[model samples]
Target: MTAETQLPQATGSCCSPGGACHDGADATTGGVTAVYRVTGMTCGHCEGAVAEELSGIEGVSSVKAVASTGQVTVVSEAPLPEEAVRAAVDEAGYAFAGRA
Candidate 1:
């Protein structure tokens, strides 16, 4: 791998051509959203599991988990602390590969 190799910045979409994923955050509240690269989410149950765990965290307003894309968008009042997100993903029986 070259040192110049750079990962795409995390957005609502997972690196689409036009950068559109439609991961909606409540604009009225100006909620903060973070896209995480979650592993081992291959089914709806897996998505639900991850969402369920993440939703328990304080200040988390919503969670949209897409299994096929391996992207989990978490919407909260503010950018969530990494430790909180990491623990939630771990508790859900998945690997937390950090933000996208």
Candidate 2:
């Protein structure tokens, strides 16, 4: 994975976590995928919010957040800086447990 420094603030909408319906017009627009363990996500709405924030990051191509599994997968052109992920999770009102 390559490196990505600063990330942009997230914008949101009512959307699913699947790479369909949102900033996910192209699943492979970016070439790298990362997974993180996010605590406090326990339902679809939680997943949606997390997905929104991650998908809004500049290099991100798609985002999949599974609240039941506490996993957030982010696809991007490069490996995102940990701080960026941390911020997105925070923006989504969750705790960043670390990479998965």
Candidate 3:
């Protein structure tokens, strides 16, 4: 018999199933939108942690993390350095897989 691993369902209006929180569009006015690949995110909590850490960086306007897709979208006033982004992801207990 094979044991199947099940992931916990994400709650909240944004992370919930079939939620259309982000359309994956670059809609930042006078800002830069960067999509980065992240690993070790398996639930909403992980998403929140990553977003929080990234959001703490200076010039960061907003951050959205989708655990299911292992993608993090960041909107900032200017282009951020890869080292900065990587440090933020590492602080969140995740691996930064670079730009997506």
Candidate 4:
């Protein structure tokens, strides 16, 4: 018998690493979606780091970071304060370029 190679299945969510996923709707609580520009992200690792830091904020439902475009899409229960977002991005060792 010949051996066959198998690969992991895709979840089909836009949350994949280093890619842009705009679900258009919040994943939880029907929250609002906000997009912000960021700097210094050059790879999936950068995206993950930014996402992680932003995800830690209160009221955040979901986050998607795209390194190529230097933009992050965030879903939250309401509009988040600019300073809060900036601080989170800074915590991840990147610069927040404001809303996109």
| Best of the candidates, lDDT | 4
Across 1-100, the per-residue lDDT of candidate 1 in tens digits comes to: 0001112234443434434334534443346667889998888888888888998888876677888888887777777889999999999999999888
How well is each residue in 1-100 modelled by candidate 3, as lDDT tens digits?
A: 1111122223334332433235432332345668899999998888888988998888886787988889887877778999999999999999999999
Cα deviation of 85 in candidate 2 (Å)?
Answer: 0.5
CA RMSD of each candidate after superposition:
10.4, 10.2, 9.6, 9.7
| Model 3 error, position 40 (Å) | 0.4
**Residue-by-residue lDDT tens digits, candidate 2, 3-35:** 122244244323434433443342324255577
lDDT of 4 by residue, 1-100 (tens): 1111112223333453433335544433356668899999998888888988998889886787888888898877777999999999999999999999
Scored by Cα lDDT, where does model 1 land?
A: 0.73
- As a whole number from 0 to 100, the lDDT of residue 92 in candidate 2 is 81
Q: What is the TM-score of each candidate against the true structure?
A: 0.72, 0.70, 0.73, 0.72
- Which residue pairs clash within candidate 3? none
Q: Global lDDT of each model?
A: 0.73, 0.71, 0.74, 0.75
Q: Give the TM-score of candidate 1.
A: 0.72
